[model samples]
Target: MKRPIILLMGTMIFGILLSVLISVLFYGKNEVSNSIDAGTKKIVQKEDKDPYEKVDKTSPTISVYNSSTNKIEEMDIETFLYGVLSAEMSSDFSEEALKAQAVAARTYIIYKKENNMTKGHKGADICTDSNHCQAYFSYNELKKNKGEDWIKESYPKIKKAVDDTKGHILTYDEKAILPLYFSTSSGKTENCEEVFSSQYPYLKSVSSPYEEQSPRYYTETKISKYKFVNALNKSYSNISLSVDNLINQINVLERTNAGSVKTIQIGDKKLSGRNIRTLFGLNSSNFDIGFENDTVVFKVKGYGHGVGMSQWGAEGMAQKNYKYYDILCHYYTGIEIKDIY
Candidate 1:
């Protein structure tokens, strides 16, 4: 009876040891799995944080490629606008016109930056080339053009224009529009489809009768027949034409909705109006060609592509007591002015 009781006690001890071993193995595996899960969650949380979370979205600093210096300069948005405004428009323009320019320029840079349309410029959001991006004027340049006293007087006005329209941008369908402004118009703005391949509703043709007030409204460029033929040959090497053939064949075939030339037949070689303008260094495509005493005379009626906002037209409206918002609305059809901030 004692032996049987001892054997029973040993069996009970063995069963207790086996239960403890199983519990230890299962608990150890579960703890490791829970730790791994906790670590993975921590990694995910860290990865989700945005680097620019603390940045000010309203007024971000931009990198400008100074083409003259071949250097990248960092500048605040408003400060950059001061340089652009000084270079783009004359200080003699009215306060309202300056204000309109400020808003348009601000919108333009914002659009360019957002779209990464800097044309592969390294480490720069924009360039100082007016043909590529927008023109910029340094303080010294402004002083040289307008004198120190005038800069002191006009700088504040330009700053006021930028300040008054701070964070303001033109939007179409709640997105920022590509606000393009030119020196002057040919009494009307061209549709986007006429100049560019894309058609934009807000960039439609609009009458701008006030641009005649601009000093650059009308310009005349003259090229001799020999020079004209030489330029054409340089552009189109295969073209074999005499001055007489050019004179007889070179005629405006079609005009855009805004009265700018669409196409011109130059000795059986059809060239775009823009191409002719570039080849001859003409001011704008809105031109009339004529032969005057062995010279090819081009009478240009505008100072730019005849699209988007006309800067001189804005000045004219401002001179007539129109507000900045009114000028913007007139130029950019069916658009809303909103504060980005």
Candidate 2:
């Protein structure tokens, strides 16, 4: 009877141990499976994610008035900027300068479009005429003008400039600004009110010391005393400008903070410097007059309106290792570089 009782207790103990071992094996398998499943899920989640999910990759379309062809053409913003960058700045400029130009051009277009400033273009958002709006040259036109070798070397650079900047634009107070830019400045940018009728906070006067290397920075235009007197007389009916007394007749009345001529006393009339620049086809309004016998030598500094970002100045900043955004911000005061889809 004692042997049977011991055998029964041993059988029960062995059964209990077997049940515990089976339960432990099943639990261990489940944990390993769960670990593998979690890792797989993590891999799948990472694979499904987009690297540029937050980035704005949209390139909008716009209408540009082709002044050469006298027609309105539709193009994507990037393609349009390719033409603008090619026509606006030298292809030999540094990559950062080119990128800065791309953003400025983009901002100008958006500002015009948002403000409904298309009446000048006959219902177009902008025009290819450099006189009225930004200049744009198509690929074929560029190939014709710049030669195939230049196209091969420079087209890619221009396209990269546009692509790298994508949809960047200059803004103030969360709104797009005019983003006016020019070939060079007279050691400083002009105040908006001095050049245009309106004043802009971002268009205030700022130092631009890098434009000295520009070919148009200091230029001399020699006009015959007879031509000078006749030109002023044609505009001012009440003035008398004798060739011998031309120096006395023409005097710079006032200069802006940027060293550009603000007002000039020509004969009996007080004219804005911009008026004289237009009349004489001068390179810029920052000019000093000197007499060389019968010639009226107009020594001018800089080019364009001298209102905003100087292209040569931008290049100068690029040479100093400044990034594109830095160049833009330096020229356009109190402005933010924003991305528009």
Candidate 3:
């Protein structure tokens, strides 16, 4: 009995000692890891010397401006390109989305001096809806698969798009491209004209709301077999002239939520709502409210904001074995990618 008690006590003591040793080992490792991380942070915090001034006629740095904040900020060419590509690739997207954005950083330094965005603010949203300088692409995507081929293929396309729009301002003839936030309340795509409504909580409400005789228009988009096919063929805008009466057909190329057929009384003629609204702005007292409803509609065609870069379309073309330049040229017109610097 004495011998058995001694053995049991010895086993208990050994177990306790093992637990203590394990705890000490874990704590020592955690402390070492913390020290290394702290040291790394210190190195990052140290100010990087600006060697840009002493160098030769160097690359152009992108300037960011905030119209609302009235502040100007600057970023490196690569960082600026990354920001542009990231935002365009996915609105508030991650940096890992594209492989193309990564490779563009290297070539942009040599080919172009600076990039610019007209309506885009200086901070996070620095690129625009269109392919001007800030286009939608990802270098990170290309880096994952196909390796260096992304540079050989994706570089010239983006560089061309950027080069073409470089030094060019967005304008229709002499009319400046006034930046207007797509009141998503009206739905996506330029097809919908945005009218201010108290319904939108995010936007500033219009003071002294005007009443209009025109039909209260609401944008509604739906994807069925027909809409998808129409969008793919770019024939969504085509108006039908002939209808086979066998099907009891409405021959019009109809819009989604335009209410009744639009009518305009101009002098002696009654024009359509679409044409009249284009000529004269919406006037109150012209039409009375019939019914009311609210909803968010996706009227988007193609994809990716229908702006500068179309990632879906690019992927589509890539699947068809289209070169990256062919994809870029299809979306952006009159752009040449050249090595300037």
Greater TM-score among 1 and 3 belongs to 1
Sort order, TM-score high to low: 2, 1, 3
Considering summed lDDT, which 10 consecutive residues are worst modelled in model 2?
38-47
The best candidate by TM-score is: 2
RMSD of each: 21.2, 16.2, 21.3
Per-model TM-score versus the true fold: 0.79, 0.82, 0.30
The alpha-carbon lDDT assigned to residue 98 of candidate 3 equals 35
TM-score, cand. 3 vs. native: 0.30
Per-residue lDDT over 1-341 for candidate 1, one digit per residue giving the tens place of the 0 to 100 score:
99999999999999999999999876644412211121112101111111112222567789999988999999898899998998888878999899989989999888888788877456688888887888998878888978989888889998899877888888998888998789898888888898888988888788786788888899999989999898898888766657775667677899998889898877758888999988888889999988888988999998988778899988987776666876787788888888875
Off by over 4 Å in 1: 1-58
lDDT of 2 by residue, 210-237 (tens): 7888999899999998998898888887
Residues forming the 10-long window of minimal summed lDDT in candidate 3: 205-214
Best lDDT goes to which candidate? 2
The 10-residue segment of model 1 with minimum total lDDT is: 38-47
